[model samples]
Target: MMGLPANRLFCLVLLFLFVPAAVCGASVTRTLSTAEPGAGEVFTVSLSIDGIDLGGVVETLPTGYAFAGTDHPDDRVLVRGQKIGFAVMNDTAITYSVTAPASGSGDITGTWEDFLDETDGEVAVSHVAVDGIETAAESAGEKPAAQEAAPRFAVVAAAAALLLAGRGGRR
Candidate 1:
């Protein structure tokens, strides 16, 4: 039989695993090709989707920004005013183009909905910087990708250590 401490430790490990998953069950990251675009310039916004398979994305563009085109199928694409929706069924990565206004700087917001799971969440916001403009992430010194991954790495390392300790006590 598992002792109280071991049982509690096991529960703690499960909590650590499930909490992050429930909070960030799935993720959608938006990236702009041209960091800073000239007035009337065309640029691309790519979405890197993870943990989603049968749903869609709805993006709301900044005022004056125009939806140009995309590689996603036409039947799955819908543009209404500044709001654009695309059915990303089975697509893990997709790219769409947009026309920067004569001059503007604003963030693009989006939401992802999983049809099968009936789950939806906000996507990470992306800034459209007109020439001479700086994004929020740029204004603040950006951290290296490795630095950003450190937290997840730490969590994984801690979990592995706990598992090893648990096994060491067994038998």
Candidate 2:
């Protein structure tokens, strides 16, 4: 009857407001495969999220870190799947490959913003330290000097061979 309809409308309104808040309370987890990375070496950064919708999920990578790609286990739908028996809207597990430049300790941080659809309730920011490639001197050592000398030696030998060939032709 008319009372039943009114009750249903009130419940629907409550759900609409409260559900978004609950959904936006997302959790973010980040893991680094290795703390120390050599120059040009590809390493993995694993990111997992529970709660928010994939469509609304925005991952912000720190400066100097390139976004290799993203991975989602449940590709069939926008929402990944359920977690802990509760409906997890956007349950995504992503692996990002990053290359560290130079040799030093670099800080990499990721922010999962707008998780709960609430403007300010983003999940905790995760940070990882990447050890840059060892110093050039330590890595290459005397090899670079040798490599540089090799080309010069080749050039000199070629010049000497050309001069000898010309003298023989004249003789």
Candidate 3:
């Protein structure tokens, strides 16, 4: 650390402190083909699941909606009423379709369980358009945003300044 230049030292510090957390944590996000869909219409939802080795997920659809189909293999998909479960192993993405019935609004909710890692959490919920109306949750359909990184950056900067301040004081 003493021999390294300032920029290089900062880069190395960031790489070491941040990379592990980013790599170990897993998350799921959903995207709707159309934010709004008509009654009796078939709509697609694309799920992006990353950082899993052996695990599964359960997607709970609003009542009156039917699971039309999915691109995932049938053997790995389980359908029980309005809920669908998918057994996943290292899969990064999946797409499924559902048919909206009547006119109503509801949240398309889900959860991710990482069996191998012994971790689980709610999937990022997103409001789907049913009968031309969006789901009620205003924050739906987006990833759980992490806290501001500016604070972390400031800490790193402060540490660097302290390291140089000692040398300047001696000079």
Cα RMSD of predicted structure 3: 6.8
In order, candidate lDDTs are 0.77, 0.46, 0.74
Sort by TM-score, best first: what order?
1, 3, 2
Clashing pairs in 2: 24-116
Residue 123 of model 1: what lDDT? 77
| Clash count of each predicted structure | 0, 1, 1
Models 1 onward score TM values of: 0.68, 0.42, 0.64
lDDT of 2 by residue, 9-82 (tens): 55555555554454435656667787666554577877676555732334444434454443444343132211
- Looking at model 2, report the run of 10 residues with the lowest lDDT sum: 77-86
lDDT of 3 by residue, 1-171 (tens): 344465456555665565445334677778888757788899899999987788998999977888999999999999999999999988999899999877766668888888876666667566665656654453375434543333344456556655654454342
On a 0 to 1 TM-score scale, where does candidate 3 land against the true structure?
A: 0.64
Better of 1 and 2 by lDDT: 1
Q: How many Å off is the CA of 71 in candidate 2?
A: 3.3
Lowest summed lDDT across 10 adjacent residues in model 1 is found at 143-152
